[model samples]
Target: QNTTSFGLTPCPKWNPNGTTIAGNSSGLKGNDTSSLDRPIGIFVDVSDNNALYVADHENSRLMKFNRSQHQDQGEAIVPSGIISAESVFLDREKSIYVAGGGKVMKVIVSGVGETILDGETEGEIGFHELSMTLYGIVVDSNDSLYISDGSYHRVVKWEKNSTNGTLIAGVTGEYGDDSTHLDFPHGIYVDFDYDALYVADINNNRIQRFHPIGNLTGETVAGGNGHGNGLGQF
Candidate 1:
């Protein structure tokens, strides 16, 4: 149940003159050559903000936008090969990482798509052998991806071209209100300059940080005394 409506509307300053762009009042979902449905992930091209890439999840495609030319709509870069795309990350080489459907896919700027990790295998580029709720991916400067798993309550780090990931944070199969555990971790960020990872522990009502490296040992940097509006709360 999506209580509220969803649509891709232009930001205020982007088009100050208020010209029409992609999408309509009706949240219609469709593939390339049509409107988007349940679009989730979006990334602005580093060199060109007008050129935005979107993970058209339900459409199983990636859409690219040229604000100057395609303000009315975006064009599909990869016409197929994506599933339930939840998040998208741009690498240094301009490739995109799509996270969803129990797999992490790499979409080259040239529109080639390949699977980097899935839940089944064990040898390399495989998630742990268990049901995984993958979300919140952050790519480090070295092209390493740090992903969070809400189902297993842990974070895994997969190096570029690696066969498997190293569990870096959280306790597997455990959820608690302590520094050693995380409850429904969401939204991860990596600070390459400082060598730290930050996680939003949603259910725990706090944010945690793993410094130097993700060693599963986290320190509460904010919100510990439960959700609230006062200082040092929520």
Candidate 2:
């Protein structure tokens, strides 16, 4: 299944790396110390001259790998919970973003992960308290960011340097049509080449595509009925 030693969801996707797609899922398990998590989610940092950063959240650290000489070689650059992280995200500048414990943190190369969108991001967006789970994040070329608020059952979009997210899809919990329907949405990806938006509607067992902007009122990418295998026609 997985070519790498392991795999992780909520992937730390890169900005269209050349060949390989580097990322990890999670190393989290229970409250106990032993059953804790493992290192998951690594990204190929071609932007940083082909480097790697692993969000080993459960073990409480981050791993940086040198891809030039050893593609698989790495070192834990930052310790876990150093940025109050649960998930890791890397921007174009090789800056890392981690979302965990109601916060999304940003980590610079020379410095640490300062809180970029957390307490204030929540307050401004009015999505903090209302939503229980927030996962599935994707960014366009310009810096526009989108996040899937699982608990509240909505997909929200926020332009860079903006505080609040404009609700663009699933504005209400009333699930009926393909456009305005989503439940427990997991992974969201944007096909920049086609200006298409792909969403892993987990609960719905399908993937949906929308225009560059959030307008889910059209045809579906995968379908509204069942899970997809990534090799079929619309």
Score residue 154 of candidate 2 by CA lDDT.
71
Decoy 2 TM-score against native: 0.64
Candidate 1 regions exceeding 4 Å error are 1-34, 68-70, 121-132, 228-234
Error of 1 at 55 (Å): 3.1
Cα lDDT, model 1, residue 182: 88
Report the number of backbone clashes for model 2: 11
- What is the TM-score of each predicted model, taking all chains together? 0.74, 0.64
Clashes per candidate (backbone, < 3 Å): 3, 11
Deviating ranges (above 4 Å) for candidate 2: 1-42, 47-52, 57-61, 67-74, 82-86, 119-132, 172-177, 227-234
Query: What is the C-alpha lDDT profile of model 1 across 1-234, one tens digit per residue?
Result: 001123766853354555434544365656645477777667666466546777777777767778756565677666666555666777777777877666777878687888777764444333553233556777767778778777677777888887767877788767887877888776777777677878888888888998877667899998887888878888
Residue range with the least summed lDDT across 10 consecutive positions in model 2: 19-28
Q: Best by TM-score, which number?
A: 1
